[model samples]
Structures are given as structure tokens and as C-alpha cells.
Target: MPEWWTYRLEDFLLFSPRVYWRMFELHNAAVWPLQIPALALGAIILVWIVRPRQWPDLGSDRLVSIILAAAWVWVAWSFLWNRYATINWAATYVAPAFVLQALLLLWIGSLRGRLHFAADRTVRGVVGLALFLYSLVLHPLVAPLVAPLAGRPIQAAEVFGIAPDPTAIATLGLLSIGAGGAIAWLLLAIPLAWCVVSWATLHAMGASESWIPLTAAGLAVLSRLWPRIGSGALR
Candidate 1:
């Protein structure tokens, strides 16, 4: 047998790229028209994000949190627990984390009423908007566009509120816009971690879009940190 160090990342993968992409195809087919309402919900979230609002309002913030929490719960139950676990046993473990995130969002935003999101013209806001649009719109198109080129199924595109990666990405984008304080940092943890996990999985599968998650994570972190860095530089 070859040495452990000699083994490629792909060597450890239990499922091939075809199997991985096909899972999405099956998932999409099974879920059917739910994608329509999911996309509509995403559009509503985008409107909420861009709408003019004073910071820390109770009603809007709580509603947004509830919406996000629902998305997390849906992705956890529908995709990770139900579908992904069949192909990757590790998904069973990951589904709990998604549930935990949903709980956190609920406890912090709905119960305690802490999360506040608003549209700002700052660098972070732009990054947040870009990330949100990418996750909601562009990310779904990725699989369909690449399918023709890569010979993958066209119906395997992942959508926001449905797929874990896009759900996490959209969460990060929403958080970046105006969320602050320790609670914001606490909320950021799981989504950022999931992005890394996603990047690793796709990288192992030799998927060309593996870097997308890592890039999103890095930009989210940097956008969050930039204000601090700017303050320190000025001081």
C-alpha cells in the first residue's frame, strides 16, 4: 500500500464527483416547486436588507431573524439530514450544527431581540450585497452553467434557503450589513465554519468551484475587520 502522506485528498473521498452532483439533481427533482417559494423568500430578504430602516428596530429585525432561522432549519432537515446523509454519513453530524445555528438565531434575534440589519454604503455593505446576490442568484446558476461544460446534470443547481452552502453564504451577507457587538460575532461563527467545511468537501471532490466558499468566508471576515483596522490606523 502507498504511504499515508502519498494519498491524495480525492483518494479519501467516498463519493465521486458524478455522485456528488447527481445528489443535487435528485434533491432538486424531489423538492420540485418548493424552489419557487424559496427564491421568493430570498427576494423578500433582499428587499428587507436594502429597505431604508433605522437600526435595531424590533419588528423588522425579529421578522428577519425568524426568516433566517426557518431557512437554516429547512436546509438542515431537507438537505443535510434527509438527502445528504444518504451519500455522506458525515452530513448526519453536520445537520445538528445547522440546527444549533437556527436555535441561536432564534434565541438571539427572536427571543432576546438583538439582531439588526440595515443597508449602508460602506465597503462592508457593498461586500454584503455582492455576497447576498451571488448566493441567491449566481450560485444557483453555477451548476447549470457548468453542467454543459463539465458534463454534469443541468438540474443540479443549488438554491438559497434549500442548499446549505447558499443558506450559510446568505446568512453571512445579511449579518455583515449592520450586525455588530459580541452577538454578531457569535452568530458569524457557524456560517464561517460551514464555509470552510464546504470548501474542503468540494476541494476533495476536485470541483472547480471549491474556492468559492473560502473566498466568501475570507471576504466576510475582512469586511467585518476593516472598520477596526481603519480605526487603529487613524489612532
Candidate 2:
């Protein structure tokens, strides 16, 4: 076998660039208008985290967690397994991880009531909130700006449930909002790993926002350690 250093970017790629971009295009087409609801869900979660008087029940946290879980399931099946795996076979493995994450979120945030939304007003919370917004609004704006660089259209932009960028970013935000513990560790494993994986994938693809995942991952680590100033209003 060839040595790792000697390998070209293409060697790591299972699909041609055309196939990859087409996958994104088809994914966007398949999930039209769904992104609107995804954006709304994210916004609601962020607002809930930021202000508690509007939603006195901790159940809002649980509800948002379930929404996030559903998004994970949708992408796990619709995008990764259905579209992405056909090109990048490794995505088949990744899909199952997403499913497990969905289940984890459902159990902790819904069934167990273990996922309390605190820690969001800390430095970590600020970073996490920024990432969530980046995934929703900022990243999509780049869709038009990077069109020339990527040779694609706005229609091809990767939305939250339809692609990894927003999903990973949104997850980082939601995960940070919770009280970190064993469940936090379990919840973070897949997303943090995906950030690294996606950083490499986006770098290899020469896509815009290539560095976003890695940056978010780093912030998340720091956010966990120094969250001494969390918002007091979380229930």
C-alpha cells in the first residue's frame, strides 16, 4: 500500500468532485422547504435558551431536544444513507452514529429530563449560539458568494437537515446549552468527530466554510471547561 504522506487528496475521495457536488444539489432538491422549519426550530431553541420568562417550563428544552433529534434522524436517513453514501460509502457508517445520537438526545432531553438547558450564557454559550446562527443564516449566505468558487447555485446550498454543516453546528449549540456530564460526553462524541471529518472533507473539496467545523469543535471544548458564568434562568 502507498504511504499516507504520498497520497493525493483524490486518493481519500471515493467520489469525483462532480459526483459530490451533484449529491449536494440532489440533496437540496430532495429536501426543499424543509430548511425553513429547520431554521425556525433552531431559532426557537436559541431564543428559549437566551430568555426563560417566555417559556417557564423546562419542557421547552425537552421539546427543542426532540426537534434536534428529529433533524438528526432526517439527515441520517435522507441525506447520508440515501444520497451521500451512494458516493461516499463511509457515510453508511456515519449514518448509524447519527441515529444513535438522535436516540441519545431523545432519551436525555425527552424521556429522562436529564438535559437541562443551562450554561448557555457563558463564553461557551456565546460561541455555540454564534455557530448555530452561522449554520442557519450565515452559512447559507455563503451559498451565493461561493457559487463562483464552487460552480454551483443557491439551490445547491446545504441546509441544516440536508447537510452536515448546520446539523453539526446546531448540535454544538444545543449540546453546549445542556449541563455537561456523562450524557454530554456521549452526546458530543459523534458531532466533535464529525467536525474533524468534515473539516478534512471540506478542505479536500475546496469548499467554502471548510474551516467552520474545526473552529466550532475547538470552541466547544473551551466552552465546556470555562462555563463558570452560565445563565441562571435555565430550568
User: On residues 151-201, what C-alpha lDDT tens digit does candidate 1 reach at each position?
Assistant: 765588889988999999999998887577778789999999999989988
Clashing pairs in 2: none
Clashes of each: 0, 0
How does candidate 2 score on lDDT? Answer: 0.77
Error in Å for residue 83 of model 1: 0.6
Determine which window of 10 residues in candidate 2 has minimal summed lDDT. Answer: 226-235
- Who wins the TM-score comparison? 1
> What would the per-residue lDDT of candidate 2 be over residues 1-235, giving only the tens digit for each residue?
6587899765787766667777777888777778788778777776776764224654677887888899999999998899888888899999999999899889888888787664355566666677777777777666677778767788777777668767987788768777466677788888899999888887787766778789888877777766456643323
Question: Candidate 1, which segments miss by more than 4 Å at Cα?
Answer: 1-8, 52-58, 231-235
